[model samples]
Target: MTVARRLIPCLDVKNGRVVKGVRFVELRDAGDPVACAAAYDRDGADEITFLDIGATHEARDILLDVVARTADQVFVPLTVGGGIRARSDVDAILRAGADKVSINSAAVKTPELVNEVADAYGRQALVVAIDARRVNPLDPAAGWRVYTHGGRVDTGLDAIAWADEMARRGAGEILLTSMDRDGTGEGYDLALVRAVVERVAVPVIASGGVGTLAHLEEGVRPIARGGGGADAALAATIFHDGHFSLSEAKAYLRARGVPVRATEEGR
Candidate 1:
């Protein structure tokens, strides 16, 4: 049986404000996280991702308050990431109502951390966030490389290979974001999404470059057909700016023959 593809709306929080931009640079304030999350939930978003883009190297808290407030208001799943470096940090976020905690730089720096969290919180609760950018556009073999520290620092690791290793190490899911497509609204990097999806057995959530319904359809259909595509597609700017509601996005995908949840069918 084919499973329905997921649609996720991402909120990049910095100083408690939802922000987004291209290449993880030039971030612009979108709105308050809690309010934005509530809106997405009401719009029938399958899940929502809250990334504390500024919590690293500064704030030690994992935006528990934001998570708590959002959980109180939203009915769907919530995945929290950014500044999740320690086991306690993961615990705090989960306790505050996050369905999953995504780890990036910490997981890259200490691969064992993925296993540790998976063992303590269960595999389904752990997600490895991979922020990747095309460092060498001229080289077709250059491939997407993982970036850490809120997409500011390059890890020099191949994104596809890293995704495979993370899955082997017990990561339940992969939130793969393309720095090049992020906030550009041009569309997701289908090539990059295909690369990671083909290499990993776990679910892959494609992020960045979802400017229109067509982009979302492109990302979700490929994955629903098989690993050679995207299982879910996430957006920040498009959803944040109110270009279209989550319900509209899902309807568009379903009409295009993508296997997406019909939660928005009535609405």
Candidate 2:
């Protein structure tokens, strides 16, 4: 049976406020994290992601209060990332009502964290977000490299290799973001996404460069069709900027032959 593709709205939070940026820079105030989540929930977002982008960059903990608030109101699954370092962090986020926690930098700092958190909460609750950038413009063969600390620190880990390792270590899903395409809205880096998806057994959420509803449709178009065919599509700016609604995007994808959950299913 074909699994229904997911349409997720990502709210990147910094200091308790939702923000959007291009290629991880020049972040602008988007809106309240809680309010944006509630709207996406009502609009039929398959899942809601609240990433505390600055928490790790600033060496602090994610705003648990904001996580709790967003979780209390949003009915769909909620995944919170940023500042997740140890078991206590995961426990706190879960306690705050997040259905899952996404870990990036710490996962790289202590690769064992993947096993630790996945073992404690079950792999289904752990997602490893990989921020990948092309190492060689002339050829993807040089491959994409993983970056940490909100895309600031290059970990020198090969993106595809890291993804494979993360899955083996127990990540239930992979949140793959192409740093080069992020916020650019040109569309997802299919080459980068396909490389990881083809290598991993876990679900991959394709993020960045989603400027139009067509981009969402394109994200999951299937590698066989020359698209990355990510299990989920995540966008921060378009959804937050009101360029499109989750429902409208899903409807568009469904109409275009992408198998997506009916809005009523989430209801």
Candidate 3:
């Protein structure tokens, strides 16, 4: 049986509140992370990604209380990221009720953490997040670079190469976010998604810049069909702004020939 493409809604939490921004700046409040997560779970989200956009920059720990609260209210897989620097941090988040842990800055800083987490929690529980930006906005061929600290720092590493390394190091999945398209609402950088998708054998989650329901479809369709070929599509703005319900988004994809898991209401 073919695997169903997943639709994940991201909650970029800061100071315990969900926020959205353009290219990771000028963030505006959306709602309480726990409340927003519960709403998505009710509406048919396959999984929810809770990213603490400020924890790494501020050098703080993830809010375990928020993770515990959200997990208690949702049944879908909960992937919590940011401020995860060590295996101990991963242990804390998992114990707090998160199903998976995503590591960004810390993973790039100490690549071994990827291996360590995988060994301790099993590869299925580790997700490596890659925040990538094109070296030249006008030139996709220039390739992409990796960014960390909530897309605030350029690591000067080739994004595709980094993704392969992370996967080889034991990342079960990769959360690939296009920093340039982040919050722009244009759409995902399909080239960037395709590049990373082609490079790594693990599942790639296409994130950033999802304006229309069509964009979500484009992110998950197969590359042979002129799509990004991502195993999953993630978005924040379109969902938070009420552009469409998660059910609507899934329905749209199904209508367009993408196989997605049906919601509880069977829409």
Candidate 4:
């Protein structure tokens, strides 16, 4: 069975407004989430991700109304995360029209949170997000470390090991972001992505650092031959900054031999 590669455009929203930043700082307004999501849906995005980057740090709940408004404007599946602390929070987010709920800080704080949510909502509805940064550029053995609270605090956990654990705990997917490569447009941390993909059974969505459409190709396909590939490629600035429309990305991947679903004329 073949799974068509997914290209998901992410909206790193803060305070109910779409925002963009490099390495999760220096945020600038992009637009309203509802409008942005509607455009992406029309452009043929496979799924939409709205992350409330400020919700966790500010210790507030996710903007459910913002999610509901965005979901109202789009027909595609929506995944939401940030400041999701308990089962009640997950329940509320799903009720707000999110198809899936991504948990990072809360999951890190309580590893069993993955199991808890999976038991209640099924694993398919739970996405465990790993915000990772390379602790040392030189040591591949030390490996990348996981961070929480919007990539601010390092949890001292090995990212690879944590990913394996999350999958074991019944997480349906892993949303892996490379903080070092984020906003730098240096391309995704393919090494880190490959490592996690190799360790986990469920699909892994590669996030951060896409400078070109080719980077998306490299992520959803192999680096060379027989190399690791992410199940999905996610980006914020690329889609939001007038870089490439979702249709163009699918066409680029199709032309490059990556197996992406064809965009219908009306989508």
lDDT of 2 by residue, 1-267 (tens): 489999888887888777763222122333667777777787888899988866453323447888888777888899998778788888988888899999988898899989988888899999999999999856888899999876789889899999999999999999999998987999998888889889999999999899998888778998898888799999888877766777888888888888888867433
Off by over 4 Å in 2: 20-30, 56-62, 265-267
lDDT of 4 by residue, 33-105 (tens): 7777777787888999988766453423437887887778788889998778888889988998899999998
How many clashes in each candidate? Answer: 3, 0, 0, 0
lDDT per residue as tens, model 1, 57-160 = 44435377778888998988899988777888888889999999999989999999999999998889999989999867555367989998757898989898
Q: Compute each candidate's TM-score over C-alphas.
A: 0.88, 0.91, 0.92, 0.90
lDDT minimum window of 10 residues, candidate 2: 21-30
Ranking by lDDT: 3, 2, 4, 1
- Report lDDT (CA) for all predictions: 0.81, 0.84, 0.88, 0.84
Between prediction 2 and prediction 3, the one with superior TM-score is 3
For each of the candidates, the C-alpha root-mean-square deviation to the true structure, in angstroms, is 4.4, 4.2, 4.0, 4.0
Residue 239 C-alpha lDDT in model 2: 77
Candidate 2 displacement at residue 143 in angstroms: 0.7
Error of 3 at 123 (Å): 0.9
Write one digit per residue (lDDT tens) for candidate 3, span 1-267.
399999998888887767763222122333677877877887899999998866553323437888899888899999999778788889988999999999999998899999998998898999999999999999999999999887899999999999999999999999999999997999999999999999999999999999999999999889999899999999988887776888999889988889999876755
Best by TM-score: 3
TM-score of 1: 0.88
